[model samples]
Target: MGAEVITVSTDTQFVHLAWHRDEKMLEKVRYPMGADPTGDVSMLFGVYDENTGLDLRGTFIINPQGTILNSEVNFYNMGRNIDELMRKFKANLHLSKHENEGCPAKWKEEGDKTLKPSPDLVGRVYEALQ
Candidate 1:
């Protein structure tokens, strides 16, 4: 997901953020990341809070194609497992390479086992793991 760029914000519409109380101050910001309010982008990923109208804390694993692969929308005060998300994203990439193989829980690229839905060579995987 890092290979691709990721952006998280709290504005649902550009206009909503554009009408900030400090219009002049916010206008000075160059990037949307700096000015987008109401969190439309955040809502797209189900992280924006409707009540408070702010970007909820979230972690989204977006693919290079601009598609969301995984998401974790929790809270700004709470913490997320960035390392684990990276591992999962890598494992998903690995499985995609071999579309026929199915990755199990906690799968990784190198030594993890992948099932092909048939008995071709299960023992071989065990040996590889060792």
Candidate 2:
């Protein structure tokens, strides 16, 4: 929960301001809407499209040490799932403390079952989930 969120795009600050002012979806967003018209930030993240002059939808969760814990990239028209994003963020946080466990795709919360990766866990994930 101690993470900062900044949504970056190729749009200018004025464009972000107008969208926040006029769009119902962005009206409640209080985080910084970063303007990357030159695509520097997007290029750094490997989401910039040189042909279209736009960035694909990308989400990244970075730890305090500046390591990227998770990255998800999608096409521009594809909307992202906040629930899944939250799940991945929570799993990353949990994994930071419980270094021996791996969160499966279905892992949703702290109390959810996690797996200990070993040779024995290779072919028995289905049984372990049960």
Candidate 3:
């Protein structure tokens, strides 16, 4: 929750400002909106479509140490799920604190059971999950 959230677009700074000023659009968005008119950042993230000259939906979760924990890119028409992003962020935070355990599918909270990597877990993953 302490992490900084930034949205980068291929639009110019003026366009970003206009959008922020639009009450019907982004009036309540207090986070920084980066304007990448040249698509430099989008290109760097491989979200820029060369043919369309538009950036696909790209979301990156970077840690405080500048390490990217998660990267997801989707088509322009597809929208992102903030709830899933928050879930992954929490899971990453948990993994950072507990290096020995692995968060399994559908793991939601800190108290959720984690998997310990071992030879026994290889063939009995369904059993261990139970």
> Pairs clashing in candidate 3?
none
The stretch of ten residues in a row with the least summed lDDT in candidate 1 is: 27-36
**Candidate 2 deviation (Cα RMSD):** 0.6
Against the unseen true structure, what C-alpha lDDT does each candidate score?
0.64, 0.96, 0.88
- In model 1, the runs with Cα more than 4 Å from the true position are 11-35, 117-130
**lDDT, candidate 3, 96-118, per-residue tens:** 99988888888887898889989
Name the candidate that leads on lDDT: 2
Cα lDDT tens digits, model 2, 71-102, are 99999899999999999999999999999999
Position 1, candidate 1: lDDT: 39
Q: What are the C-alpha RMSDs, in order, of all predicted structures?
A: 7.3, 0.6, 1.7
What shift in Å separates residue 80 of candidate 1 from its native position after superposition?
A: 0.7
TM-score of each: 0.60, 0.98, 0.89
**17 in model 2: Cα distance from truth in Å?**
0.1
Better of 1 and 3 by TM-score: 3
Ranking by TM-score: 2, 3, 1
